[model samples]
Target: MHADILLRGGDIVDGTGAPRRRGDVAITDDRITATGDLSDWTAGRDIDCTGRIVAPGFIDPHVHHDEIVLTDPGMDCMLSQGVTTIINGNCGFSIAPLTATGPLPQPLGMILSNDAPRFATYAAYRDRLRADPPAVNTACLIGHGTLRINEVANLDRPADRDEIAVMARALDAALSEGGIGLSTGPFYPPARASTTGELTEMARVAQAHGKLYVTHMRDEGDRVIEALDETFQIGRDACCGVHVSHHKCAGLANHGLSETTLAMIDRAMQTQDVGLDTTPWTASSTMLNSGRHRQASRVIVADSTPHPEMAGRDLADIAAGWGTDIDTAMERLLPATGIFFIMDEGDVRRILAYEHTIICSDGIARGSHPHPRVWGTFPRVLGHYVRDAGVFDLETAIRRMTSMPADRFGLRDRGRIAEGTYADAVIFDAATIREANDYAHPTRPAEGIDLVFVNGRESWRSGVHSGARAGVVL
Candidate 1:
């Protein structure tokens, strides 16, 4: 007869690929206890939502906040953006669920050092969350490269049978201890040397335990098709599903390749297993020392600190400005600045419209012109592609960011707005919502979010955060 919180007169999308309808939702404790007309329900707190699209809170399937949230739990960047649940451990670069201790991954260098030492294994990371937490709920996958190289320290060649056995043992340990799946980056430094057979061995281990295989495919430029084929082979051999993390083709040769590439996935999904995640923007951002940037035709200096002159210049422009060769300029910025504005807009539209694709933010909190996607990913999808570009219907677009990812990762109780589910929801004006971020000035807050709730408690509303930590790490 009584509810913990009630949202009245909101348009509900539910994230189930269903049509939107006007209704009310009532929460008891942290679960949605009732839906449909509840105008008569008694409640401890009630919020009027007369003009808003109330949908399941966006669940970011791929994220890179391993260190940011540990230090800055505010998550105002994401919270303000309406993200409730974020899945980290993407691209084999998580600080945690490491099977052993050694040099931390390349990404750990940018986030923070204190967080690095704590990530020896999945259990160690989970133990940390049990004690201290972040503002948004996070489910971490085991970074494959972390487990393999952290223990062995180096595996440029295929692992021996015995070495493979050791890594598999450590991987199984992490998965059983609550790792969501296996994340690997064939495009990162430590992961670059990993051979297919070694990855297949780990994939089998994940498949055995019902975990996923998410990969930064071996190559996305000249060898993209080959890399994708290799991924499909691994899934087929391991008998598990595979996800392509931040699927994109970089460099001039790679522009406009998404249609062909997604066609490959569409054909593969008919029988074999494969999927992808992409941001709703043309430019993908990343650390300078990353494999993709190192091999890119040119790693533009989007923004740089300690060198303001080069902040907004591209690689060619930076090279010209500094009176140095492009490679020399790239070498200089690779140490501190991250780059953006590198992918094809045509490809981005093609991938977002793919039926098998989900959306994700492979973001860095510290980048100087970080692709606005970091702050505007989910909101941009709702405002631009769905409402403006007419790429997908409201129901379908939200599903890619919500239920599609939740179901892919086997998260059972959260994505959809349903009775007995955790009431993580968002209320925003569909007509007014839009991303204010751009490559020139990337930190602008999005417009039009009226409210955000995690676990049935208000987190943000009407341009002000409600100062609550309703998030509980999973």
Candidate 2:
């Protein structure tokens, strides 16, 4: 008889790749109560959505918000982009299931802050999140690197049989405590020495619990075909779904190789369930690794340990200033992060245009000069790719950001605008929506996202947070 909020007069894109229709949405508490012609519906508040498009709140499937969610519950960067839910613990860099005894390893320490709270067990971490949730809902995967750091002390050798068994036990316990799946970044130093047998064995633990197996793959450049084969073999050997993180072909030598890699994914999907997520940008950013920087045409220092003032400078310039090679400069900057311009524009577009491709920010919520994708990913897709370039229709684009990711991660009730579903939605002026963030100004919020609702509560509206921390851990 009564609605908590009424969104009246808008084209509803239900996020099912369905055609938009003029309708109104009625929300009662945290669930959508009704849709279509709610002119007579009485509600506590009315949000005029005239001449705007209302769709399900976006889902980011690849993000590293594991520690920030605890440190900054507001999560304003993601909320401002209409991202209601985020899948954290990506790229084998989760912040939990480790004892607080030893030093944090590479890449993991880079993503998390120095003083992040440590949890001895995965269940303890999930319990803490449930008690004090962040502004956006979060789902997590247990990173293989997390297991390695906790179980195996050496980085130069593969885990022995006993170590593998111990890792498997930890993974099974994490899944039992509500981890969605397992993720590995074999390209990173922490997990580079992990053998295929070690990964397959742990993936089987996830598969037995009906969870996912996602990877950043072993390589993305010269040996990409071999990496693709290894990824597919892991999925088949473990008997579970496989997801590729930030799918792309890197380096000038591999400029247009996404065509080949994507085809390989399609062929692999015919035999096993496979999907991927990508940031809609031509540049990729990550921890400072010599191998990555060697292939990149331009490498910008995002954050540095030894030289704190070198955040926004180019790596080459820093080397020239020091009268040494770029590699030597990088060594002086010992623990650092960088934005590498290596991906091809054509490859980025083709991947985003793929039907099975899910949109993910893969955004890092750390550093002074963080990648622009952290703030601009979702809007960039809607504005630059969909609205400007006509890469895909609006409805299709919405599906990629919303239902595609929700379905991939098993968030069954949060991706569509219909009765009996969670009222997580975004209202925006489709014509005016665009990303304002760039590499130099990475923290700027997007424009034209008028309001964002998480679980029927107005989380963000008109460039300000409403101070409502109503999000939950899923």
Candidate 3:
């Protein structure tokens, strides 16, 4: 037999949560033509994968890489960690459905930054990606906040009946343009004013199209139970699957509530489709919110818009430097981004070990000192959780990052090492694979990832990106 490429003598995990097996994977063009004993096969290119784990390239189900993909098409940050696919426009933030050429609304702009691209609709945004594809496959969800900012004049109040009708129509149009589903971040100020009826209407639009509904619930702290109930009700009413983004109970007072939240999700799953995503860090980063900041034990300024020099400094230190209280200092650094050290490690591991939980970076890709999870999430799970802590076997961890996300997000022909699947795979040394990035130095890449293939093209090899723009916009 002949093939375009052959990866021989590797221990394959296959991304299915099954036991590993020794096999050879053969590829022709952009698909895996065969996998097994291919000792006699002749190939144009040969890669010796001895003593390595060759598995499906990691899939990040929850990320905010929407705008970063445009400026950095190589996506070296993600590729270095073996993340070949990402779901963007998370947390009810997207760069689409823009009706004019102006600054993004306060909430949406906070994540994407002030310089995000402007598109009249989702189709236009998709077109931009097609023209200059990134090195990773991307699926997008229409942001409910993006829709609200475009249609509703005042975000301080709930949309009226007519406004809701308009947003629904806009959602229908965006879904037609190949958007996978709907995402909402009700915790953000622009979306905080949204009523249950408003969200139900948008979810129904996604349901009518047979898509999913993902949300950053109204609360992840003390009132998380109420938030979970509201989310389940939306799923039930809309008849769609629900995905909770970055699921965790924040604040020291709310510690150890993953027990309660996961139990609620498990019970809800008995009747409805429910899943959650978790980043492998105890700190959360996003646009600075005074309310959330107050609850946090410590805060590090990820980026200070008015004062860029304060990027990596601690919030309390900045306050002392300015001779003001923490609250006053935070107010002066308005429209900034920061990391809230609010979660417990126990809660993080409990959630990651859950069967229905998928791995996501939830990494805000921008800012000077971005959370280390941006560069380290996938490797951290594989090295720290699976290998070091004995949380679960390596295969189980790989399943959460690969097949589980692919299945939940409806990514066709992906997340598996099988015949006819897309040639998206990674080869890494299981013994050495681990995260190197930390809060102080967040942009460093992971180690031990040898080669990464996306759509039959070598995108990264030996810690160096090949500058291949072979990614497809899904």
TM for every model, in the order presented, reads 0.94, 0.99, 0.98
Candidate 3 segments whose C-alpha is farther than 4 A from its true place? none
Q: What is candidate 2's local distance difference test score?
A: 0.90
What TM-score number comes out for model 3?
Answer: 0.98
Write down the worst ten-residue block by lDDT for model 2.
94-103
Q: Estimate every model's Cα lDDT from 0 to 1.
A: 0.79, 0.90, 0.90
Screening candidate 3 with a backbone cut-off below 3 angstroms (N, C-alpha, C), the clashing residue pairs are none
**How do the residues 235-324 of candidate 3 rate in per-residue lDDT, one tens digit apiece?**
999888899999999989999999999999999999998988998889998877637787788899988778888988899999999999
Positional deviation of residue 54's Cα in model 3 after best superposition, in angstroms = 0.1
Q: Is candidate 1 or candidate 3 better by TM-score?
A: 3
The better candidate by TM-score, 1 or 2, is 2
- Best-first order by lDDT: 3, 2, 1
Those runs of model 1 whose alpha carbons end farther than 4 Å from true positions after fitting are: 99-105, 111-115, 290-313
Q: Mind giving the per-residue lDDT tens digits that candidate 2 earns over 25-81?
A: 999999999999999899999989999999999999999999888888899999999
Where in model 2 is the C-alpha error above 4 Å? Answer: none
